[model samples]
Target: MSWKKTSITIVMGNDKYPKGTRTATFNNIVPDPTEKQIKSFAEGLQLLSDGDTYLGSEVIKHDQLSAE
Candidate 1:
């Protein structure tokens, strides 16, 4: 039984829409990523954004099941 990371989703909060309206998704993330790496990546994205705020990030993963 193993899980594989599929992508990272960055949620952005907008002034007009308080409940976060934008999201940036990056696929094919490295396996078992560190917290620091995810934080740094989100912060870096915040810098490039216009007025959107960095609400948080979501690390999406999926597991494969097989019957023997």
Candidate 2:
């Protein structure tokens, strides 16, 4: 079976303004992900998937944030 892995970001939003709620974002890598990276990511998700889904994060430099 072939599965595609994806990356997503979870963000906390302001509760005071119900309409101002912020949603998590998902950013897809460009130039195509390597086969090794794809396999590893899929495996990680599978290991964590026990009837439920989970999200992971890796901190990057503030300047590295993409405006796109």
Candidate 3:
């Protein structure tokens, strides 16, 4: 068998989380995330996680926030 390599990166925010804090939104017991919502959330997370000491912003699609 041939050897393979993979890389994974994890970044943490500065906020202090409780010891037992865990994500429950993705447990499937609640409503699934829409494609637009997922994309928006991912972009927001990436912006916050980026270590660069510069301010960055982007406009999200209005429909993503609307309940329609």
For 1-68, candidate 2 gives per-residue lDDT tens digits of 22234444433334443664333444554334555664465456546544323333332222243456
Q: For residues 1-68, could you state the per-residue lDDT of candidate 3 as single tens digits? A: 22232222222333344542222122222133454655555466658653322122223221223345
lDDT for residue 23 in candidate 3, whole number 0-100: 29
lDDT of candidate 1 vs native? 0.79
TM per model? 0.70, 0.32, 0.30
Q: By TM-score, rank the candidates, best first.
A: 1, 2, 3
lDDT of each: 0.79, 0.42, 0.35
Error of 2 at 28 (Å): 2.4
Candidate 2 vs candidate 3: which has greater TM-score?
Answer: 2
lDDT of 1 by residue, 1-68 (tens): 66755788888887666555887799988866688999888778778877767788888877677785
Query: Of 2 and 3, which scores higher on lDDT?
Result: 2
User: Best-fitting candidate, measured by TM-score?
Assistant: 1
Q: After superposition, how far is residue 25 of candidate 2 from its true place, in Å?
A: 11
